[model samples]
Structure formats: structure tokens, C-alpha cells
Target: MSVMQGDGRLKSQRFRQAREGDWKRLERLMDKAEKGSARRLSDEEILAIPVLYRSTLSALSVARETSLDRALIGYLETLCARAYFFVYGSRSTLMGKLGAFFRRDWPMAVRALWRETFASGLLMLGGAIAAAVLVGQEPDWFYAFVPAEMASGRDPAASTETLRATLAGEDTSAGLSAFATFLFTHNARIAILAFALGFALCIPTGLLVLYNGATLGAFVTLFASRGLGVEVGGWLLIHGVTELFAVILAGAGGLRIGWAIAFPGDRDRLDAAADAGRTAATVIAGVVVMLFVAGLLEGFGRQLIESTPIRYAVAGTSALIWGLYFYGPRRRPAHV
Candidate 1:
């Protein structure tokens, strides 16, 4: 053991001596660049940085394996770390990074989860259709599906005249500020739950999403029975387009997480979940922004605009903008 240690020490010293010239040259050049501006370095010096970096990396790897002198190892580590920032770390400003994220990263991630998105969409649609059909067949099913608190007196018992009054009554609903805050608080909780509970293999997420659709369908069916379907559609659409889309995206995020856990393929389960969670979390954060916009629309615009055509226009415009943002043609992505 004593002989082995002495031999290792000799090798380390020889290694350092042979490379000392290049190391000194790199150190001098880096010091000069650090003193003022890297821009001040000549093109030759700039080109040499990466070449020096690769050699230094090889030296560090050898140092770690051979268990070289602690001071020598420490010096190499510090040098490599400084070079790594210039070579690999992002140089963009915070706002520039934020802009690029929405423009590229977010949409690319959504496209990657297209299969999960389709599954979530199908589940919600199936729930909505089933509820609508059942309620349409027998009016009593509306009460079973929709909660009384959410119904707000708009149910099967409401006459056509009474249903019309919702659109006409300006001061009857909660004030704009209070209502928006309330809506944001409520929907945000549901969205977060649908995301957080996905770890349980997506059973909770599926149920929550299904329930979301059922309530909407139940409301529609109740209004349709009273011959005020068109009015209610406009009333709902103004905010529903953004809000419902946000909820759907949230559900997609949960499903993505669950799917990763179930089918890790080559990776370990934790690693697979972590990668999916990063992308899914980005989508969910954007959904919160969507919900904020929806709350404003629901509180301010939906209450004030009784014109069905204009309401449809607002909803259609929102849909078109989101569609383009997520699914429109994009530039070829640069390597990150």
C-alpha cells in the first residue's frame, strides 16, 4: 500500500509537470479575459478557450480517479466550473428567456403530450355527452348531476322567462370583483387538485375532469328544456372557452405524470416522473394564467354583454388565438 501510494504520487506530479505549460497559458489568457472583457481576447485566444477546456476536463477526470493531491484537484475543479458557465450556460436576459419559453418550449411540450391530451379530451367529452343525453331523456337526472350551489337557481324548474332573466338582470349576480376572485379561487383549487392527485395513477384526475364536464352538460340540458339553449350557450361560451381549455390542459398534465410513472420504459420510475413533471408543470402554470383571463371575462364581459352574437364573437376569437398559439406552424426549433 505504501509503494502504491508513492507510485500514484509520482504519476500525479509527472502529469502536472508535463501539462503545466498549457495550464499556465490557459490561466494567463483567462485572467486577462476576466480582468476586462472576454471580447477583448483575440479570435485566436477565443478559439483556444474550448480546446483548453476539453484538456482541462480530461485532467479533472484523471485527477478524480487517481486521487491526486487535494490542492491540484481543487484548482482543476474551480477552473472547469468557470469555463463551463461560458461554454454551456444560457446568456439570455430573463425576459428573453420568458418570451422564448411561451413561444417555443411550452408549445413543443404540449405537442409532445398529444396522446395524453387526446385521452383527457375524450374522457371529458364522453362525460359531457353521457350526461346531456341522460338528462335530455329524463329531466330528473339534472338534479343528480349538478350541485345546487353551482346551479344558482338555474335548473330544470326555471321557466323560459326566469332563465332569460339571468341575461337581463344586471345587478342580481355578485359584484364583478368579488365574482372574479371567487371564480379564480374555486377553479384554481380544482385545477391544482386534478394535477396533484395524478400520482394515484390518474383515477382522481379522471373523476375530477369527468365531473367538470357533467356540470356543464347538466346546465345546458336544463336550459335547453326551457327553450333558452342559445342564450345560455352564449352566456357560458364567453368565459368557458378559456376556462374549460385551461381545465383540460390541467387534466392533461396529470395524465402525463401518471403515464410516465406507469410506463417508464428505459428510465427508472423517479427519473421518468421528474422529466414529465417539468414539462407538465409548465403547462399547468400557463393554465393558471388562462383561468385569470377567464375570471375577468366571466365577471366583467359575460355579465355586461347580453348580445348573443357579440358573445359568440368573443368566445370564437379567444379559441382562434389559443389554437394558433398552441397548434400553428412554428419555426424550426434551435438546440437548447
Candidate 2:
């Protein structure tokens, strides 16, 4: 045992002696950079930062594998961390970061979770289709699918004239602000809930999305029953495209985290969850903006535009713009 200990000590000492030059070089560079700024670094030193960081990381790994002395391991770990921050961490201004987030970080994050987003969207669609068909077959099913408070007195038994009046914004113009506020708060709440519940393995997220879709489906059936389906479709789509898409993105965020929690692959569960949270959080940020857009359309525009064609046109335009924003050609962050 004493011989083994001696050999270990000798090896660690030899290792340090061989690599001390690089370690001191890194230390000097870090000190110099911190004294002024990374921007002050010469081009050659700036280029060396990543190379040195990677080499230090490699050294750390080897030290751990070889079971080097804990003190040496600790020093290497600290050096590697500092190097990582200097090389990869952002030192940009807040505006610069925000610009990059919208330009690249968000879109890349969204693209990373396309599978989860697709699944979330399909769940909502299934619920919508199911509720639409069931409620159309039995009008009372509307009551079951849509809560009375949200119904706002428009039920299956209401006369066609009453329903048509609502769609034409005749009696509903005064309620536009309240309507927009309500939808904004409601969708925002659902999106947040979906993301928060993702730690529960996404079951709650899926169910919440499905319930939202079903409510819409039932609402559509009521309009169809009165032969006002086309009118109601226009009213809903004016903002529904953005609102619904926002909700789905929220669900995708939650699901991404939940999946990471449930199946962390080779990474640590906590680490995996953290990684997923970063990406998911980015999507959620964009979801808030989308909900704001939806709210504006629902509250203000919906009240002014009573023409079915105009309503459809507005909805189409919003959808097209959103499509281009999320799925458009890529661009490197200008200032990132």
C-alpha cells in the first residue's frame, strides 16, 4: 500500500511538472484579460482561448480517470470552469442578447423541439375534431364541453338571430376590451400551467391542451348548428391561429422538459432537466409575445371587422407572418 501511494504521488508530481507551463500560461492570460477585457486580447491570444480551454478540459478528464490527487483535480476543475466562462459565456450588452434571442436562439430552440411540438399540436387537433363531431351530433354536448361562464349566453338553444348578432359585433363591440383581456389572461395561464406541469412527465400538459381544443370544437359546433359556421370560423381564426400556436409551443416546452426528466439518456437527470429547461424557457418567452398579438386581434380587431372575408384575410395574414418568422431561412445573429 505504501509503495502504491508513493507511485501515485510520483506520477501526480511528474504530471504537474510537465503541464505546469500550460497552466501558468492560462493563468497569466486569464489575469491579463480580467485586468482589462477580452476585447483587449491580441488576435493570437483570443484565438488561443478556446484551444487552451479545450486542452484544460481534456486534462481535467484525464486527471479524474487516473484518480489523481484531489487537490490537483480541484485546481484543474476551477481553471477549466473559468476558461469555459471566458471563452463561451456572453459578455454582450442586454440589447445584443435580446436581439440574438429573437433572431437565432429562439428559432434554433424551437427547431430542436419540433418533434415535441408536432405531438402537442396533434393532441389539440384530435381533441378539436372529436369535440366538433360529438357536439354536432348532440347539441347538449356543448354544455358539457364548454363551461357556462365562457359560453357568454350563447348556447345551442339560442336563436340564430342572437348568434348572428354576436358574430356581427353589433352587441359585442362594447365587450371587446374585456374579451381581449380575458383571452389573453386565459391563454397565458394555460401556457404557463403547461410549462410548469412538465416536471410531472407532461401528462398534465397534454390534457390541458386537449381540453382547450375541445372547448373550441364545441364552440364551433354551436355556430354550425345555427348555419353560422363560416362567420364564427372567421371570428375565431382572426386570433385563434396565433393563440393556439402559442399554447402548443408552451406544451412543447413542457414536454421537452418532461421527456428530459423521464429519459435523460446518458446525462445526469438534473443536468438533462437543466439543459431542457434552457431551451424550453426560450420558447415560452416567444409564446408570451404571441399571446399579446392574439389578444390584440381578439379584443380590438375582432370588434371592428365584421366582414367574414376581411376576418379570414386578417387571420391568413397573421398565420403567414408567423410561419415565416418561425420556419423562415436562417440567419446568424447579427451581433451575437
Candidate 3:
């Protein structure tokens, strides 16, 4: 038994000694990679990483099978795990990842959803037109579409002077910062809900988006009845261009998922939905950013800039920027 134990020890020591040099080299490479110094490595060293990693994996397998010293086995296990991640895991740094997302992933995802976006925009438009016609014929329909809390006395019952005063920035119950935060939260909630409810065959998402447009139409019709149409248009458009677009995109994201589930074609239902989800997720991320920008515009720009023409100009500028950003032609990335 003593002699057998001695032979095993000798075998373990020889095994480690044979591969120790390669293991140390791999460790050095891992250290540099972890420290973000991989660019400093020579081409030879960079190419050697996978070779050394595979060697280390082989060593670990041997150690486990041979029941080598616990400490030695543990060392090989740790080395192999680190080497696996260093060699095979994502190579992009944090900032690099963010740059890729903005430059490629987001815009690409939005472009892919053009069909869904058009459908969503049409739904919103249809709802708005329907509500406007209804309320134009019977002002009482305003109460049905616009919630009382949101109306805040801006309903048809309010006097023309009172309604116009609201658009003229007369209401100042909340600080600008607080108001911006509130708007951001509210808009984000609606956008996220629209995205989340998309899996329910898209019915909820469609209704939610339509309801939002109806509310907007109700407000517009109410103001139009009092001859404040242009004023309200400017007031809403200053931020609504971006805000409404974000909502539309959110609805589109949900609709994509719903459509996938409804017509999976040759793919499994879950698989199709998953594929759509990846693209939708990217759009949703960009939508959050759009909502944030809209919140700032609504909270600050809308309040500070009172000229109707200027508001329209700002809205047009925003629309132009968004159009060019999403629809402009660019060279596709190789990886994408």
C-alpha cells in the first residue's frame, strides 16, 4: 500500500510538471485579459490562448480521473474555468457593448419593425379620428374618453378662457423637475405595459394604444371646440412627437410578439415569439430613451417656449431627427 501511494504521488507530480509551463502561460494571458490589457499581447500570445486553454482542460480531466492531490486538482479546475471564459466569452468591454447597441442593434431593430410600426400608428390614428368625430358631435363623449384626473378641468365644460389659460402655462402646481419626473414615470409605465401585454394575442396592447390616442383626441376636440386647437396642437406636439412615437414603437414591439404567436409558420410558437422578442427588446430599450427625452422636452421646453410657431418648429425638428436616425441608410456591420 505504501509503495502504491508513492507511485501515485510520483505520477501526479510528473503530470503537473509536464504541463506547468503551459498552465503558467495561460494564467499570464488570463491576467492580462482580465486587466483589460489583452491588446498588449502579441499575435502569437493571443493565438496561443485557445491552445493553452484546451491543454489546461485536458489536464483538469486527467487530474479528476487520477484523483490527484486536492489542491492540485482545485488549481487546475480554477485555471480551466477562467480560461474557458477568457477564450470563449464576450470580448467587448462595457463601453464597447454600449456603442454597439446604439450604433447597430437599436436602429437595426427599429428598422425591422417597420411593418408593425405602421400598423400601430394606423391604430392610434384610427382611434384618434374616431374619438374626435364622436366628441365633435357630442361633447359628452369627452367624459368617456378622457379620464377626469387627466382632464384636470381642461374638459369641454371648462370655459374657453380657462382652457386657453391651461395651454398658456398658467398651471404651475408642480415644479418643472417634479412634473418631468412624473411624466417620465407615467409614460414609461404605459410603454412598458404595452410591451408586456403583447403576448396576450396583442388585444390588450391594441386596446391600450387605442385608448391613449382616444384620450389625446378627446383633449384636442375639447380645445378645438373652444378655438384653442392651434394652441393645444403646439402645446402637445412639442413633446408629443417623441412621446407618441415611443408609444407607437412600444405597441409595435408587443404586436410583433403577438403576430409571431398567432402565425408561427413553420417555427414553434414559443420559438417564433422568442425570435421576435429579441428585436422587440432592443426597440423597447430605445423607446425608454425616447421617453426620457420627451419628458425633458415636455417638462422644460414646453413650459419655457410659449410660441406656437416655435413649438411646431421644435416638433418638426424632433420628427426629422428621429426619421433620419431610424430610417437613414448606413453600412451594415459585418457581425450583425
Q: Candidate 2: lDDT of 285?
A: 94
Candidate 3: stretches off by over 4 Å? 1-16, 32-47, 55-75, 170-174
| Per-residue lDDT over 1-336 for candidate 1, one digit per residue giving the tens place of the 0 to 100 score | 999989988988998998877777778777876676777889998898889988998998999998898989999988888777766767677999889888888888778777878887887888888899999999889988888877778787877788789765266456777877888888888889888877878889998899888888888888877778898899999999999888888899999998888888999999999998998998887888889999989888898888999999999999999889888998896788
Task: Compare the candidates by TM-score and give the number of the best one.
Answer: 3
Q: Taking the tens digit of each residue's C-alpha lDDT, what string does model 2 give over 82-161?
A: 88888888778899998988888888888898999999999899888999999978888889889888888889878999
Expressed as tens digits, the lDDT of each residue in 132-240 for candidate 3 is 9999999999999988877879887788888887876524637778888888999999999999999999999999999989988988999988888899999999999
- TM-scores, all models, native as reference: 0.77, 0.72, 0.87
By summed lDDT, which 10 consecutive residues of candidate 2 come out lowest? 168-177
RMSD of 2: 7.5
TM-score of candidate 1 relative to the true fold: 0.77
lDDT of each: 0.85, 0.89, 0.92
Superior candidate under TM-score, 2 versus 3: 3
As a TM-score, model 3 comes out at: 0.87
Question: On a 0 to 1 TM-score scale, where does candidate 2 land against the true structure?
Answer: 0.72
Sort the predicted structures by TM-score, highest score first. Answer: 3, 1, 2
Backbone clash pairs for candidate 1 read: none
Candidate number of the best lDDT: 3
Clashes of each: 0, 0, 0
Task: Point out where model 1 deviates above 4 Å.
Answer: 1-80, 168-174, 265-267
Model 2 stretches with alpha carbons more than 4 Å out: 1-90, 170-175, 332-336
